[model samples]
Target: MFRRLKTSQIVVDVIVAVGFFVIAWPIETITVTGALGFEYRLGSLGSVLAGLVIAGLFSGALALRRLSPALALVIAWVGALAQMSLGRPPGFADVAIFGVLYATAAYGSRTVYWAGFASALVGALVITVYLTAGPMYAGGLSWQTLPLALVMLVAAAFALGLSWTIGALVRTAVRARENRDAQQRAEAETAAEQERVRIARDMHDVVAHSLAVVIAQADGARYAAAADPAVAAGALATISTTARSALADVRLLLGQLRHRQGDGPQPTIADLEELYAQVRTAGVQLRVDVDPAAQGEPPAAVQLAVYRILQEALTNALRHGAPGGAVDVRLAWLPDHVDVEVRNPVEPGAPAPARVGHGVIGMRERAQLAGGGLDATEEAAVFTVRARLPIGDPA
Candidate 1:
């Protein structure tokens, strides 16, 4: 509840209320000297009591700052009338203080104008009572005081309007700041979610491809050992190498979960030839056409993206294509872009496979991250995967 009141406004209200009471007490004594027909000292005591009552009224109004403006205005007006009726020379201070309180409640709402109207009416009434009654009871009422009361009413109206304008501006500034902060927080969360999806895709590509190669080589070694010792030994050696390499790759990927900064080695486009050799050793006939003149060195992220795409495409071919069928790998390096294509003959009876698995999704995501694209298609008896990476464009 306290959070609603601005600290400066609270302090100002308290100070103003106390100041008015201090000033009004002494002035009341002088105004009532001849009219009350009492000793000046006794009149001064009465004035002090009146000042205390008015102070209580103003303090009560300030305490209700967060309440409805209409309710607070009604309370303040009642207190102002009471003070005017009891005091020796009724003053406009009560109305002026209430006007300021009403203005404060007007911020960011239409309550200010209504409160101002009510305060002005009450202020005019208090002034009229002071002018007619004080001197009339003493048999010497004057006309000069009417103009003074009118002047005070005009000044009160101006103060109320000015304060309301300032309060409205302050409320607008606060709301704008809150909206800007909310937008920044939302953007940060969106960027974090995208990074998480990218990491999941990379993990799927690495694990799926490595395990497929190891399984194919192990099966070849088991079948060939009885027929030819030399071929069986070669197959076993290739299986061992494939398993070790896969283990290392898994370790590298898992390290990313531990630390984001320099936790393991990063593979790039230069590793593509070694990748082809492994698939060839697993008994698939692999053909490679890579241009040496192509931009040999690309940005680190682009290099990693290209390596992952090729890895996923080759793995899919080895797992799904005909045994010992030709898997063609093509790389065309242009002045402004590089294109990679992998195509393999589809095995019989598996046309329109059940689903394109995570491998294809990973390849597509990597291509997108590098400001490129991937397309996979099946035409006639062949399945093809193609990716294009732009050199200078970073999306």
Candidate 2:
């Protein structure tokens, strides 16, 4: 929020510099008039305006205060040196000193921030020394003036220090707020990416599982129509049922894509029964066993994780297991976590599939996202996928 392009800042500073020039002109003129006239009934209006114009020119560096604080500081120093050379008393144009010092701390680079701090201390000392010794040079110097010099020094130091401190505090606040805003933006982007990944994974699971079953049933029907028409008829029925369910799942997923987060339907633990039945009708002997020990139902997020893992695992088995293989599904519920394992038979000495796919990766990611773990391995002609999911609420 504190940041601004230098191009725009330059224009703003120019306008501010003009404002300062206008205000200082009148104040400097009034001070000159009151000093020369009220004190000694002397001095012309034309002379007062001429001297004030020169002082106002020195303060013109305010135009670059924010855009280039170091440059502004340099210009301010030039003005101060000129005023001291002319032995001029304090005037409204001197306000640029505080303005420049404040800009150095609030808007400058590292070098300039510290440089402004040093200038504040040094400038106060210079002012006190110049004012104190001016009387000495005028032939009226004495020990009685030392206390007044000390008072002037203290007051000048306090004013300069206060300006720098306020600028430093503003700088710190702006930086802290920007950092917090950046962190929030990063977190939001991460959430959006994760949601996209999750949707892709779900679409893969639903379509892959349904199509695998349909293909198996269609192939079985193609070969068995003449010898046993009843077997062919049953296969077609299973294919129909699986396709309709897949179509509905796809429609729901598409709807989710069009809506805001949390507006879509989520699968839970109870959906596993229909999955097993679909696989069984594809001519694979599917067996399921569940041992319940937890007192209450799991959170929806954990159940969704468990469901997706099993769905993908069963899909893999149905597509790659040995022909007419018997798949074993087991679920063991614990107090704080649930365990799921799917085992399907393959050829006795067959090698692993030639190319690895995202099925295993997706399942592993799902488990980990739920604050748990998963493993998929093939051993002794049996492909096994095991996963554990925590029953805790979703983050």
- Best prediction by TM-score: 2
Each model's TM-score, in the order given? 0.71, 0.87
Best by lDDT: 2
Error of 1 at 256 (Å): 4.3
Model 1: clashing residue pairs? Answer: none
Clashing pairs in 2: none
lDDT of each: 0.68, 0.80
| TM-score of candidate 2 to 2 decimals | 0.87
- What does candidate 1 score on TM? 0.71
Query: What are the per-residue Cα lDDT tens digits for candidate 2 across 254-280?
Result: 877788447377787788778888888
